[model samples]
Target chain A: MNRQIHLVERPKAAPTHEHFNLVETSIPKLGDQEVLIHNLYLSVDPYMRGRMSDAKSYVPPFKLNEKLVGGVVGEVVESNSDQFQTGDVVTGMLGWEEYSIAPEKEIRKVNPELAPVTTSLGILGLTGLTAYFGLIDICQPKEGETVVVSGAAGAVGSVVGQIAKIKGARVVGIAGSDEKIDYIKNELGFDEAINYKTTENIQEALEKACPNGVDAYFDNVGGEISDAVLNLLNKFARIAQCGAISSYNKVDDQGPRIQTKLIKSSALIKGFIVSDYAERFKEGAEQLGQWLQQGKLKYEETITEGFENIPDAFLGLFEGNNLGKQLVKIGEPQHAKL
Target chain B: MNRQIHLVERPKAAPTHEHFNLVETSIPKLGDQEVLIHNLYLSVDPYMRGRMSDAKSYVPPFKLNEKLVGGVVGEVVESNSDQFQTGDVVTGMLGWEEYSIAPEKEIRKVNPELAPVTTSLGILGLTGLTAYFGLIDICQPKEGETVVVSGAAGAVGSVVGQIAKIKGARVVGIAGSDEKIDYIKNELGFDEAINYKTTENIQEALEKACPNGVDAYFDNVGGEISDAVLNLLNKFARIAQCGAISSYNKVDDQGPRIQTKLIKSSALIKGFIVSDYAERFKEGAEQLGQWLQQGKLKYEETITEGFENIPDAFLGLFEGNNLGKQLVKIGEPQHAKL
Candidate 1:
């Protein structure tokens, strides 16, 4: 039997469990060039929130009363393609179900011997590439320059801070909790971390943290936090507008106009997603892997153990409940040995 | 005696006539490498509004009770250096007075025979250069792409539209008056023009004008108009944020958050002043001159006579009263021929 989660209703603001439905069905058969896989892990992300809305966006919105799809690592239980075999581990966009049928072209085999299989979904996958390209290609932080990143404790932000450090920039991170502050500062080698939840005055805290002024910004959370960083920008500051998780749930988010601020600083703000740099993924992935092997990069994951808890893990992202990449451990590989 | 305008008080919101005071004083002697200029044309621009207040910006705030300084086209009535001679027409940053002193390095000779001397302050100078760099370098509008420019009948916006046409892009202009709309579309050859003041729904009008969607936007007025343009951006759209003239007088300008729109389109927004491209000014000036001489580019100037009218001309900018470049004719050359 297969249990799959489906979007039953569109969310106007914050998503709740009522918007989703879990349906049980029999496993499907595989066709030519297709493989049947028993799911091992499912990745949940903040950007997924955008897919729940029926708005014009980079990608099309998820359909109602249908199986929801996302990144997944699973083991092939049956194969009708020569490229994939039984007992092989792979990763691709698959349904949020216990058993998934994947066309050969839609999935790629993951070599567990290279690193942990979960790393294929986190540190070495889209999350890490997002940090790499958005930081290196967009922001381009220079040596001794100050780089500020919002959502500093999350998956992409954690990797962004580490990469900025590697580029010799003075990294200042803004996160919600003291634990996230300590983790990014002490564990991730960030120069400074601000607990935005406890900081009575964010502008004052940012000024104190970035005394030399911000030259580059990686914005995951936008709102007053972004406004504060914008106020302290040096001339020619570059901002990688990666995400606006802060305003993603709001119907109408209003703030101070930023045109004057951008003009005064002669700054550049570029909004992008990881797939925009799809052609250079190999180069980025190789570099991130090398950094990991050399102990120059580190990562953490908050894994929820059951498929039933997938919605909770996704919802927790908005509340700042997860540190690093958030993933759900579905089922153990039935036919694969690791 | 020399006549001058001074900022008597800083304006909290919109500047009024009371904020300025006309003063009279005797002209001073010139030192070595100095020349005395008989002011002919004084350029009153929108950017000067920022200098009136004590806010930190690209340029320093105007000092209280001091002579206002700006771009001037004048004659060298007295010279103390070999670099300049008496009767030589020159243009530089000079005081708003009938007689003013300038060092040899501060002023550069303007060839009246090449074009009109007034062109030195309008088309063949900073105004043209601002349009050139902001459009070609920042927006980089490709052929067949649709380009929209706000403040499209003003000095910089007019030139930006012409240049976009020169680059083979479909140009759509937004302005305040129907006369200005007729001018940009009929005379200047813009593909379409919208009289934003009379347009019931700017977004719907823009949709009709730019059926291909907006690939590039040169934003001079940043408020509701910019919000409308931002909503219609195509994938990878580029916005040259030159000025926010619409919000200059508002103490606290508020508007819809744009981060999500930017992310949805994977667009880029860069704010700049002409001086940011000072190194390439000569290249920009040469191209503009060639275009103007070849009859590919056209310009208009609304000349307000007399130095005393400088404040009125400056204030008229906020009301959108000027057709193109706003200049106050202070005095004619007493020692030079055209």
Candidate 2:
């Protein structure tokens, strides 16, 4: 029997346990060109909150009473495909169950010698690529310029600040907790960090942090935080609107009109997802790996053990409970040796 | 003696007659490398509203008790430089006065034989160039894609719709009146027009008009109209934010937060002024001239007679009283032949 999590009901606001169900079922069988994967690590992200609602978005909403699918790192137990063999550790979009069956085209083998397998779902995978393309491609921060990143200690923002720093930019980060502030400022070498929860005046703190004015902004948590950053934009400032997790649970989020501000500064703001740069994934991954190997980049992960706690881990993202990439470590590979 | 208009006071809300003062003064004398200009046509624009307040913007705010300056078409009556001679009809940034003096480098000759000299203050000048660069360079509407233009009956917007049509895109115009709707649809050949004033449900009207989602939006009036348009953006949509006349007077303009919508659509929004494209003005002007000469493009002018009515013409823009470019015909050329 395999255990899996399913979306029992759609969420109108913040998701709770009632919206999801844990079911025990028979392991899915493999078909032609398909591999049976024993799940090892399951990834939970803020963007998944958007999929919980039946709204028209870039991707279709998660189906009710159906198994939730997301980034998964697993080892093949049985294979019927030439592309993948049994015992091969891989990463792909897979189910929340203990076992998942995926077509060979969907899963790609991960080399454990290069880095930890978990990095495949974090720094070396979609999260890293999101930070890379959204910052370099959209914001294009020049040397000596200031780059402000919201959600500073989250999966994507941590990498964004480091990359901006590598590009010789003054990096100022905005996060929720003092721990996050310390991590981003001291550990990640961010020029400054603001604890939005404690900061009485976010706009004033941002103005003090970014005295030269913000040249590039990587917005992961948009709301009043973004409103403050926008107020301090320099001429021709570029904003990479990567996420708006702040408003994902909000029904009627409103703020001051930004048109006049945009016009006054002649700024540019672009919204994007990682898939928008699908063709250049290899290039981005290669660069991020090089930065990691050179000790110029670093990443952290908060691993919550047990598959039953996956929902809690996902819910924690909204509360700013995780330090970096949030993942749930399930059963280890039975057939594959480390 | 010369007549001059001065910004006597800055208004906290909508500007009124008390904010301006008309005074009789001695005509300005030409210094070395300067020309004495007999003002003919003075352009009254929406952007001027931004200049009235003492706020930090692209250009400095209008000084109190000082003569107002704007785009002016005039005749050179006294030349003290090799760049100009007496009787040359020219256009440049000049004071809102019957007689003014400008440095030679600040003014350029306008050929009346090419078109009406007034065209220099309307279609063949900044207004035309604003529409050209904002639409082509920023929006870049593809063939068959839907292009929406707010403030569609006005100077910059009227030209934007025509250019989008010329680009083989389906053009949709949003205006404030039934007459403006008929003019944009029948006269300018826009595929659709929404009279925002009469329409009870702008979002529903827009949806009916644009079966396909909006791909490019040339936004000249930003407020609730923009909010409605933003809701219907297709993936990879582009918005050229040229103006926010709706909220220019409002001290605290508020609206629904757009970051989530921008992220969902993967759209791009850029704010700009015409002078931001100054380096490419020659290219824009030449293209506009060719289109005008070929009769592929057309323009209208709501010319208010007399220098005394200049303040009223400028104020009328906020009320949407002008159909196209609003200009005050202060005086005709004293020394140049029409």
Candidate 3:
């Protein structure tokens, strides 16, 4: 049987679980160069929130009365092509569904022996690639430079700080809670970590943490925190704006005023969507995966059990509930069960 | 006799005549390798206004009762150096005075027969170099790119448009007056011009002018006009912030906010003080001089007569009184009667 969640309506303020409707039907037949897969895990991200609204953005908005699409790992139950056979593990852009039928171009063969299928939805996939390009390409971190990453406990932000450290830069992180702060500082090897929730003056904290002023800023949560950092930037500072999770909810009335400081401080601020670097995705994924195996890079996934809890898992990102990459585990694999 | 003007008190708002005091003294003795230059012309720039306040800046603020030092063109009356003989014309950073003494390293000798020495204060000097580096190096303009230049009829801005045209870009200029707009479009061959004074909606005008959106924005005025242009920038737009002439006189409280757009649009905004590009001065100057000789570039000077008029000429810039480059004819050249 085919069971999937469909987007019933566009979100206004905070998206509720009722906005999505689950539908059940019989499984469809597979075509040439196509494979029918049973979903294993689905990944959720903050940028997906932007795609849900009917606004002119980097990517097209999600349409009404359709299964919401996202990155997912699955096991092929049936295949008509030589590229995949029944029981082959694959990952690609699927949906919030129990089973999906897709073309060969949409799915990538996942080697379960090399790395877990769930890892393909996080560190070995888009999340890690985003951090790689956002930091190394955009920020151009150099040895001995000080790098500050907001949302340091999240998937992309976590990788950005560690990569900056690997480049010999002094890394500082800012997260919402003390536990995430400790995880990033002690476990992730970030030189300093600040709990933004408990901190009163962000500018003072930035001044205290980065005594030499920030050389590079990897912005994930863009708002007042970015404003404070902008003021404390050294001459010719570089800012790689990856995401604005903090302002993504309420963008109009008050996105932090960071422009005045840009002129006075002579800083360089650039925004880039990672898909713009799609040509180099394979290279970035390989490099990121290698770093992970070498213990130089580490990633944590905040897993939500059951396919029904995808909305909760997604909303947890905005509330700073996720530790690293946020994902929902749909079903257990044969290897795990054995 | 040598006559000098000293800054007595800093102005709270607009500077008055009383803020400057003229004093008479004996001609200062020239040291070995020093040239006694009888000051002929003095420059007035937006950056000087920043130097007038006691605020900390890239360079030190102008001291009380001290000569306000800036670009000046003059003729050698007596010389204790072989580098420049008596009656030779020169240009360099000299005090606002009737006569000045400069070391060999401080001044560059100019050929008055080729181009007027007053031009050493305008098109072929700091102002020209500012336009050269700001547009060519920082903006990195490409052929067919839509470029929007603010303060489009001023010294640096005038050359900025001409260079963009030379580089094969569709140039759009924004200026304070209709006359300046006409001059830029007619004389400089800018593709389009906007009289900001007569325009109601700058963003709409910008959209109408550059339908494809601005690929390169050379910002000379950094207040509301810049804020309007920021919205119309395309992806990967490069902005060279040369000077903020519009708000140079205002205090910190009334500053404009434009940096937020840099983050949102993923634009590259770089603030360049021409002094930072001093290493390439000779190369930039030689190219500018060549452009002038070929009749490819043109310049205009609003020359105010006499050393006593220096303060008034400078204040004219803030009031938008000067048509092109503002300069004060400090004294008659040594060979004026030759």
Candidate 4:
């Protein structure tokens, strides 16, 4: 019997493991156009917090008493569709369950010979494409420009800093802890790192670190830290707002006031949902995969074991517990490193 | 002797009438590439408020203790170049004084036979160009797209609403009073009008007024009212932030939080200083002039008499006291209607 976790209710704050219940059932018979996936890994992201609530967002909110869905990597156990075969590894929107049945149109079969399947959820997935498009298409980072990334240790922020560095821009990463700072600077090769938790004066730190003023700001956290970054932006600066992790989990409205700073600096602040660029997803993925193969791109994943731990893994992202891509180890690692 | 005002000290807040001191001096000597103009009408605008402050803004701040500079229409008193002759009416950044001298490259000679010289400072000048570029270039307002303009009773905002209407979009204007609101909708041909002061609930009014949600929001006031409009924006909504009249004069450092709404709605909020698009100024001016000649665009001016009243005229913009193009009738209207 395959056990699957189903959502019992919508969570108001940090979702505990108890918000879901594990139910054992026989896997549903695959339709003529459907394939059954034996889940190997499931992604836990900060954006999932928005889905957990019934409030209107970019996408429809998660329904109560329904399975919570996110990005997942798995191997096809059985396929009735001609597009996919049994034993074929694939990735798509799979809920936190041991098994998933999706139509051929919904999943993309990964070529394991090209890269690890987990990378499908990180560097080669929505996170990578988001960073690629947000930095290149939105901010259009110029050479020698100063780029600042907030929530620098997270999936999207991590890649944004790396892409900015690759573009020959000075990269500054703002994270929650010293460890995350080291990961952003030492491991990820950011030019400078600021530990937002320990810094007494964010404005002073930004001035000391970014003397030239921030030309581009990739905002992942929207709060006082964003306010500090706002003050440090140069005239006609570009701000690519990919996420607001710091305020995502807040029950009350506590984000800092930043409209005045934007006006004063004549800045361009744009917020984008990655799925809006689905037509260009292939272009982003192909370029990112080449970068990874050439050793020009790097990624990290904080994996929590077991399918039941999906909620906790997601909650950990808001608490700044994960260093990079937050994921739940649903089954076993299906693909060996190339 | 033709006297001219020079650059003066930057003001921290609302500039007083005393901030600009009248000085007596010989008309500036024009070199081979220069033209001397006897000042006629001086234009006062909201953008000059930013230039008065020493803060790093889009345009360089005004230098201390000198006559302030702005767009003005005057008559050429002397010409040292072939571009203009004495008695030719011209308009450019001719400072606030009785007389001025500018490089021939800076002045654009206007023919009173085509239109009034003061019209060059209003409908055919920076205010007109700002509306054309900020609407057509930045907002890219398509035909039938719902367009909303704040500060719609003022210069740029008034022109912006009318242009959007001419483009076939359902235009809504927000003004401070019922009379202004009536003027915007009835006289300007806007689809709807909102008296922001009398409206108890802005969000509800926006919902009822703009039932389809705004496609392009031409924001002149960036505060609570704009924030309310943000929530009603559809996906891919474009916000052209031209001014922040709501918070410009407020001494407090607080305004509504707008980033979160922008993120959830996947909106684009951009701030623009009109002069940045100087390359397109000629095209804009020509188009605006045609629009005026065809009677497709109409503009009104709140002409305050005398040089001493310039500060009061400018300050009136923040309070929404001016009807349309706020200008001081400095000296006399040199190029009058025949």
Candidate 5:
């Protein structure tokens, strides 16, 4: 029997435990060119909040009473294809179940010896590549220019700040807590980190942090915090609209007015999902892998355990319970022989 | 004596006739590299509204009790440099006066035979270049794609729609009056036109006009209308943030929430001034001029007689009283021999 979670209802406000249900189901038998896998790690992401609403978006809404699915790293238990044999470690979109069945072409095998298997979901996965493309392609932070990132302690924002640093930019981060602030500033080598929860004037704090004025803004947390940063943008500033985690739960939320500043500064704002650069993913991952090997990039993950706790892991995202990448460890992966 | 207009007070809402004071003053003596000009036509643009406020913007605000300034087309009456001679038609940023003196290099000499002297202020000047860069560089409308333009009968929008049409795009224009709508569709060759003021549901009207969904949006009037357009944008749509004529008067106006639509569609919104493309001005102008000569572009101007009527011409922009370019004709240009 495979344990999995299902979306029982659409979320009206912030997603609650009632919205999801955990149940047991049988693992499907493998078909031709198909592989059966035992799931090891399941990834929870902020963008998934957008997928819960039945409104039009980049990705379709999750179906009610259907099995919830997302990025997962798993160990292939049985295979009927030449692409993979039992014991191969692979990652792809899969159900929250302990075991999943998929075609061999749907999963990409990763070398466990090259890096930790879980990095396929965090630093070296979609989260890190999102940072790489959103910053480098959209913002293109120049050397000595100031780059301010909101949700600075999150999986994506943390990597964005580090990449901005790697490119010799002045990095300033905004996070919800002091510990997240310290992690970004002290551990991640950020130039400055501001705990927005304690700051009286966010605009003033951002103004002081970016004395040269904000040349590029990687927005992960939108709302009042983004409004403050918009006020401090310099001429020709670039904004990478990554996520709006803060106001995602609000019904009919309106942020600040930007035309006054955006026009006056002749700025550029572009929104993108990581898949927009799917053709260039290999290039980005190679660069990120090289950076990790060279000790230029650092990352963290706040992981939970068990397949039954998937709903809790996903709920913790809305409450800001996790520090970095939020992952659920379901089982250990056995690497295939080199 | 030169007749000119001066800004008397900053307007709280819509600017009135009382906000402007007509004055007659002696023309200043010509200095080295100076040229005396007799203004032929003065442009009244929507962007000037931003400059009327004391607030910071792309251009500096108009000074209180000082001579108002904007784009002017004139003919040289006297020259103190080799760059110009008497009766040479030229265009530059100048005071709203019948006669004025400026350094020769500050004004560019344009040929009357190549196009009308007034074209320097409308089709062949800043107005045309604005539409060129804002459309081509920002939106990059592709063939067969739907391109929706707000303020469609205005100077810049008219040009923008025509350029999109020239690129083989399906053009839909949003204007205010039925007459303006007819003009854009019939005279300007727009595929469709929407009269936003009369429409009960703008989003529905836009939905009907753009059956395939909007692939590019050239925004002139911002606020609610733009919000409607934002709702209909398709995947990877581009938005040229040209002007927010609707909200220029409102204090701290919040246009619709773009973060939601922009993110879902992965759209791009860019705010720009014409001068931002100064280096590419030559290329943009050559293309515009070629289009005008080839009959691929058509334009209209609602010319108001007399130099004293500059304020009325400018005030009419907010009221949507004019079609295409609004120009105040001060005098006739004496063209220099070719």
Candidate 6:
């Protein structure tokens, strides 16, 4: 029997636990060239909210009765293909179930010796690549320039700020809480961090932090925070728009006019997803791994212990409860390495 | 004695002709490295509206009781520098007055033999380079793709739509009036044209015109029209944002959330002034001139008859009363070109 969570209802605003239903089902037999993966971890992300609604979006809506799917690292329990064998550690778009079946072409073998299997769901995965391409390729931050990142303590933005610092930029972070500010400033070594939740005026704080004006901005949380940062952009500034996590649950748009600000300084705003740079994933991964090994980059993951807590882990993202990547550890590995 | 127009006060909304004060004054003496230009033509542009307000912008606001300076083509009536001789046709940022003095380096010599002197303020000048770089370099309109231009029959947009056609793109134009619609569709050779003033639903109209979806957008009017065009952008669409004439007089921001639409399709929107590409002006000018000579591009000028009507001409831009480049022909050319 497998415990799976289904998106039982579409949410109007911030989703509650009731929107997702936990149900039990029997694990089916694998077809030819299929691998039965015992999903050990499940990634809960803000982008998943976009998939919860039936609106036209980048990814399709999650079906009402089907298991919610996301990035997961698993151990192969049974294999009927030459590509994957039993007991192999793999990562793929698997479900929230204790057991998930994937086609041979769908899963990729990840070496556990290089790093922990869970790291594949964080620093070396979609979120990291999103930070890598969105910062370097889009904004092209120059040394000594000010680079501001919203959602500074999130899975993607944490990496974005570090990369900007490695490129010799003055990194300023905008986050929601004092703890986030402390983590980004003390642990991440960011040049400056602003707590939007407590600050009376984010614009004034940003103005003081970036006296020379922001030259590169990595936008992960768009709304008033974006408006404040946008007002401080310098000439020829570039914005790498990754997500608008703040508005992912909100029904109404809550931002000021952006065109005039963009026009005044001749700024550029480009929006993109990580899949846009799929061909360069290997390049991004290698560099991120190198930075991790060289101690220039560090990561933290907030892991929920059981499959039943998956929905709560997802809901916690909106509440800003996680310090870094949010993941739910569902099963123990069949074998351990290093 | 010289006649000049001054910005008397900033308006709360749309500027009226009364906001300008036309007065007679004495022509000032020229210092060393100066050239006295007898103004023949003054350019009327929407960008001048931005200079009317005291707000911080790309160009400084017009000083009260001072002559409003803009692009003007004139004959060198007097030359204090060896670089420019009397009788040379030149263009400079001179005033609305009949006679204005400028430093030698402040003016560029325009050969009447290469093209008409009036063209120095039109297709071969700032407006032309704006269309050139904004479309070719920024948007990169490709063959068979749908290219849409707002303010389609205006000075900059007319050239942008034509350039898209030259690039083998399926061109669509959006303007205010029926005459503008006909002019762009029949005369300018645009594949499709929409009159936003008469259309009940601009988004639906745009969707019909750009059935294949907008691959490139040249945004000159940035309000509801921009919102409609932005909603129909295809995957990886590019937008060259030149102006926001539509919002120059508006009091409030009116547009739906664009970040979601932009992120879903990985769209790119860039706002820029023509001078951003100053180093490549020569290259842009040569190509524009060649296109004119080859008859690959066509142009039209809405010339106001006298110096006294300069303010009215400038005011008329917001009314959408002109086609192509609007120029105030102040005085007869000292000598006609071939």
Q: How closely does chain A match the true chain A in each prediction, as TM-score?
A: 0.99, 0.99, 0.96, 0.95, 0.97, 0.98
- Which residue pairs come into collision in candidate 5? none
Q: Count the backbone clashes (under 3 Å) in each candidate.
A: 0, 0, 2, 10, 0, 0
Question: How well is each residue in A17-37 modelled by candidate 1, as lDDT tens digits?
Answer: 999999999887789999999
DockQ of prediction 1: 0.88
Give the better candidate number (2 or 5) by TM-score.
Answer: 2
Runs off by more than 4 Å, candidate 6: A336-338, B334-338
Which digits, one per residue and each the tens of the lDDT, describe model 3 over residues B1-338?
77888889997666778888887778767889998888888998877876777753456789999888999988888889988888888899999988899998899888878887778888888999999998998788899999999989998899999999989999999998988988999999999999888899887888899988888999888777877788788877899987777666555434233343554566788777788789999999999999999999998788899877888888888777777898888677656322
- Cα lDDT tens digits, model 4, B1-338, are 75545445555565665566557767656688798787778898887777777766656887776777898988887789898887788889878777788999989878889887778888788888888888987777888889999988888889999999888999988899988988998898999999989999988999899988888999888788887888888888888888886666555546445666677777888777777788989899889988898999888988888765666777777778888888877665443332
Q: Write the per-residue lDDT of candidate 5 for residues A243-313, one digit (tens) a residue.
A: 98877898877855676577888998999999999999999999999999999998999999987788899
How does chain B of model 1 score on TM-score?
A: 0.99
In candidate 6, the residue pairs with backbone N, CA or C atoms under 3 Å apart (3 or more residues apart, or in different chains) clash, namely none
Alpha-carbon TM-score of each model against the true structure? 0.99, 0.99, 0.91, 0.94, 0.97, 0.97
Decide which is better by DockQ, 2 or 6. 2
Residue A59 displacement in candidate 5 (angstroms): 1.8
lDDT of 4 at B89: 85
Of 5 and 6, which scores higher on DockQ? 6
Q: What's the CA error at residue A22 for candidate 2, in Å?
A: 1.0
- The best candidate by DockQ is 2
User: Candidate 1 lDDT, tens digit per residue, B17-43?
Assistant: 999999999888889999988989999
Worst 10 residues of 3 chain A by lDDT: A251-260
**B229-277 in candidate 6: lDDT tens per residue?**
8878888999998998988887766566678778887999899999999
Candidate 4 ranges with C-alpha deviation above 4 Å: A9-26, A251-260, A333-338, B1-34, B333-338
* Ranking according to DockQ, highest score first: 2, 1, 6, 5, 4, 3
lDDT per residue (tens digit) for residues B255-295 in model 2: 99999899998999999999999999999999999999899
Report the C-alpha displacement of residue B62, candidate 5, in angstroms: 2.6
Among all windows of 10 consecutive residues in model 5 chain A, the one with the lowest summed lDDT is A329-338
User: Which residue pairs collide in model 1, if any?
Assistant: none
lDDT of 6 at B226: 87
Docking class of 4: acceptable
Native A-B contacts reproduced, model 4: 0.49
